[model samples]
Target: MAGLDFEPALAAALTRHVQGITSVGKLTRLSGGASQETFAFDAHTASGTLPLILRRAPGGSRDGGSGQGTALATEARAITAARACGVKAPEVVYVLTPQDGVGDGYVMERVEGETLARKILRDKEFDAVRPKLAYQCGQAMAQIHQADASQVPELRLVTGPQQLAEYYERYRAYDLPKPVFEMAFAWLKPRIKEPKRTVMVHGDFRHGNIMISPKTGLAAVLDWEIVHRGDPLEDLSWICINAWRFGVTGKVVGGFGDVPEMLAGYRDAGGDAYTVEDVRTWEVMGSLKWGIMCMGMYEVFRTGYDRSVERAAIGRRSSENEIDLVNLLIG
Candidate 1:
């Protein structure tokens, strides 16, 4: 603590609200938030040193990558609602205001788990839990879908057409052409008919965004920035997208479980009913959406807002979705 720059301001603020926090230690930035900044640290108190995360949107910065997602306040609300529906999630401890000096964001009780896509897919430690992931994902998504928007009026409702247009506009901003995107857009523009139904969706609820424990299959669902009201099946499709499979493409449901087990779990958890055909349509849309999102990150980096190698790297991976689109649509 003597040799390094210690975090006092945040520590002091946390101490006041965190109750009996004798010391706050090791304020290490874990990674960047999807639409903000994320940090991991310890709060030393009478009980023990508590591991927690700070997700901040940096006062005046544009919500990082894209403005499509919810603000920190809405994200906190979504997490609260998800927890109420019995979904495993980080308990939001505080939502910092302009006065907190830590910027606009929130602090949450960190749940320790492996969220790395490859580790969960290949690690032997997760061998047992791997088999049950898809089912668990289904059951959890049901609970997430139940988090009604009426209670959390901060969330914006987005229809299928609206979402498609939003992504299309982002893709256009890139000003680069991908024949695959064009083909996928053409095929989907007509067929992707939404029934005007809406539900709370964990927009980026997939392998990388979800945390899993080796002993328990799923630990906590993280990243609610993109939480919105949309088609319930969108969550299912997002999970099944090939980009999330992390090399185990044979198993469609996040490269660990089959679709049948997932759907069965969904049914048992009282999720909305859907057919294979319904998922097929959404999968194509999901694939394109992921591609567009990758481009959005690239745009952020390319525009000189935030220079990160990871963001630049992701821009190239959009081609992966291109191939997936071709296989799903024309093939």
Candidate 2:
């Protein structure tokens, strides 16, 4: 479906859904999406041009396998519910149907901001707003967790121990073992305790998934495919993972600010009272989780399931996570 024509179907859908719309214009595919297809286009209307985005599954199919996260309709519902909770999420304009001729996905308002982590961390244009990003991220995360579970579509309830067992099994399935990973698992198993309460957590609340503006800081949180109901601390710790720092390891919170500042923002936004130690424990789990995911990438590449150079490149970074784990645990 790479070269499939979407202009005709888009024109029909936009004209019908969007009031005073004429046709679609200048559809361009955006990069950096590994699982889904994303396209940006203009919906020319009688009033003015509307910037919109189309996120669809490849070949117009609805399913993306078991580990691929939720379906498109569920993702759209999550976005809508997050927006209602005051989180900076994209407006879900329309969800695509089979009769629409477009793929099984949704159309959303195109948010103008930077989603690249390296550029956001290193670029001079983002200098002024960089320091505030971590705290803002915490605030945004608080809003996401505050969303009513009933308002959003039903999501899987994944506890810390359940996630640990699941990922550990995934790691062992590849028949590859590392002392660092085994040790990390052992360290995490005993510490795994049931959460006193659960909330909607943004499963992947790291750098690239967040949109940052040069002016107002956090613009919107993108990529709701992996959102789930779980401990809110998972969102806090996932951002502190070393891999998300993008080489600025000194700044513990997404290469921008310290943990205290992030917590301050979290508290200001009415989040649960959590301490640094709580986040650190989850950080260790997050590091090991990422390491196993990297190994999975390599396994797919080696088994000829995915032959892309990008997968091979990411697979090589599994060792870096091990080094991070050693420093975090052994030190």
Candidate 3:
């Protein structure tokens, strides 16, 4: 019932496009993912009942402007580019423009697999799949980074060092008291330099954003809203963040593969120039970035854009995890 009433308009729109649409069945919103709204629905066309997913921007806008349309289009474009690069991503079926009357959303194949972060790491049934995850993650990221940024011109919106600076600026804009992050920024500012190579970086690469099957190593990588051109190491470091190790901090690298193994896989695939020092810098940056981002999430909830207790708790924990990273780096 989460999104049932909100979807009749979409069903009507789809009926106009696809012939012989008989009925649009129940539409239920899936939990998790704070930035966007996701729904699973059954489409009963003349042919058969088709399972589909609908993704729309949060509250249909950002920054007091109706630009979710553009973001949705960008997501579609990014998914296409990722698929072309041999990265496992859901196939985009339709992109709804503002004029299309869907309020900026897209329909894609509903990928079947486990996407829960902790389950992917701790589920014994996934033990075989888990060990290969880091390697697959490295390989998939290498492929994603290898993608020509020009293929998706929207990625030109942000570059490497600017991206880092932008993240910091975003935190400052939040106007939260973040002394730990302030220190992290001070430590990271001087080291912010252009990458040796600019490649397609998955801005939010981590175990939680990935999907894996117990029978298969990796099913697909979800969430393309943050795709951009930047240092490939950003993706590597984001994956290895201690927060994502699923209670296996000592294992690192998503608590499955070692750092050397991941780097070796990446390097073997022509992803040279990424060194331990480079990854360390990004790792530190990732911790800082996630911590600030968590604060932003709290702001969203406070502003009534969302009211989930989970968001509130996550925001509160951001500083603790960030402080842990600070201790790791400086202690």
Best by TM-score: 2
Per model, how many backbone clashes are there? 0, 0, 0
Give one digit per residue, the lDDT tens place, for model 3 in 145-210.
877678778665454578678888788888886777888777888886777788887777777678
CA-lDDT, candidates in order: 0.82, 0.87, 0.75
Tens digit of per-residue lDDT, candidate 1, span 137-252: 99999899888678788677787777888878878878998889888888778877775458898888897789999999988899888898888888888888898888898888
Comparing candidate 1 with candidate 3, which one achieves the higher lDDT? 1
Flag the better candidate by TM-score, 1 or 2: 2
Task: Please give the lDDT score for candidate 3.
Answer: 0.75
Q: Report the lDDT tens digits of candidate 2 across residue range 1-331.
A: 4555867987898789867778888888885354678889888877888899888877566654246487777788888888888999889988888888887888899999998999999999999999999899889988998888776646888989989999899989978879999999999998867776799888999888899999999999998888889988899999999999999999999999899889889989989888999999999999999999999899889999889998999998999999999999998
- lDDT value for model 1: 0.82
Instruction: Assess the local accuracy of residue 74 in candidate 1 as a C-alpha lDDT between 0 and 100.
Output: 79
* TM-score of candidate 1 against the unseen true structure: 0.90
Model 2 global lDDT (CA atoms, 0 to 1): 0.87
